[model samples]
Target chain A: MKKYGSLIGQLVIGALIGFFGMLAVLDGDFRIDLSPYAYPGNLIILAAAAVLAVFSAYRYVSIRNLAKQDLSGEEEDAAEGRMYRHYADASLASTLAILFSLASMSLSLLTTQPLWLLIFGLVLIAFSFIISGILPGLMKNMYPERDLPSITDKKYAEKLLNVSDDGEKHIMLGGLYKTHITMNSLLLGAIVLLLFYSIASDSSQLFSIFIIVGILAITNTQYQFSIRNK
Target chain B: MKTRLKELRARLGINQTELAKRAKISRQTVSLIERGEFMPSLLIATKIARVFKEPVEEIFQFEEEELK
Candidate 1:
């Protein structure tokens, strides 16, 4: 849920790239060259792109399942807990998809492989815009009825206030907040490091941003594991 | 933590939604409380107890093993 903002932002960026890529394709500037570039550099780029694409697909599926699970089940708190867990997973999947699309773009730029570039760019757009942005809500719509009571109701607010004042509930809520903050900080640090590395490297600005996003995605997974194992 | 929320609610002949409304909490929160899956704050416990016209201690009991 926390990741939605960033996911939307990324989706916008990906959509923009796809929009331009589509223009290039329609203009016939992007062509499918069946003949391989046959250079070692081109080969490496293609290989990397392939790997990232595979991972992106895998992550998207994982997120879809997690989202489904988060919305289902009997226990309200347990469902909420699942939501917290899936937020990180969904963020990671979005990042991977973005990275895969970017990798394809990079490969295309390096080898003049318009097909790979356009294909991956479109995939990135779909993953970001559709998968990360709107899929969860759509999936949640499948379960139109929610058993959990709305917090906005006057009576519910009183109950919440009552529950909130209790020692154990207070402690539990506090711990969840603390953990969320810690994970955010850790992810922020990783982004900072990626920024520095990007500046030090020869990659394009877009590539650097994509790499930072990839790191941010990884941090979510790491945070989940750290909490679970601890 | 152990609670007699379900038993009390049953005795009162009220559903979770009604009790939750009266208690000023979400239906899910009330359900969770009844299931003993969530621990409420002192105020909430007292409020719930008040709704049932019983002492908080009468509705909720703490187990020593649970504390450990």
Candidate 2:
């Protein structure tokens, strides 16, 4: 229970946000206007992107330096492990920055925004793409002995899993199992909420509900098939 | 299962990464084994035993209830 406390809290918060968002959409007067705040918002987003980029660069350089150094001592080996963790964190931050910037660019495109906003969004998107692209290569530098595949490779997932040790596989299995259970539960809850919304608003949620159910069926079937013979 | 992995590594004057490299496993696995968070396979146990020049039984011990 204690282990799942934060997950449960996040789920509740997400559900509440979704509920309010749906309510706003159904109110019939909901409108999103970002023209007024576009300049300042984009500037803030650019600043955030710059900060993340700098942090990722710092981690990359640090890992590179550590990897090149004589890691023969116990302390040096421990430092290498720390670098790996820092690299993972930095990679996650870079991905988040990319996603956030992309979302902001989409908003700019959707709303009545200025030309300069669009250009800024494009530059930010390009910068994000470059950062995300370089991260995997930085990770590879830390493990020069292993032949790590690029993210764009067709067999990257299989190759990566093959390279993982049993303990890492065990951890991955536990995480994936939890994610599967959570996804199924969340999809079921979403169906229930859609049903209520449809009934209350006198609007058909059949399409959305069918899509959700279809996704659930497909994923469950895939999981079952993958392990049925095992 | 409890393991004297840390103790053995210390005796060998090696860190987790060195042990992992010698045992042909991940450093994370070495750490997990030390923390008693994971029960290693016979292959891994043997490998680790080889690294520390000890028997598997000497490195990993099972409690009475765990045996049951």
Model 2, span A1-230: residue lDDT tens: 98699899998998898788777667655344436786677667766766776677677778778777776667767887888787887787677667667766776787766777667667766766777677777757676655677878888779889888899899889989999999999999899788766756676889999999999999999999999968
Candidate 2: residue A52 Cα off by (Å): 3.0
Q: Which lDDT value does model 1 have at B66?
A: 70
Model 2 has how many clashing residue pairs? 0
Candidate 2 Cα outliers beyond 4 Å, as residue runs: A1-47, A147-153, A181-217
Docking quality tier of model 1: incorrect
Compared with the true structure, all predictions reach lDDT values of 0.59, 0.79
Clashing pairs in 2: none
lDDT of 2: 0.79
Largest DockQ belongs to which candidate? Answer: 2
CAPRI tier of model 2: medium
- The per-prediction CA RMSD against the true structure, in angstroms, equals 15.7, 5.6
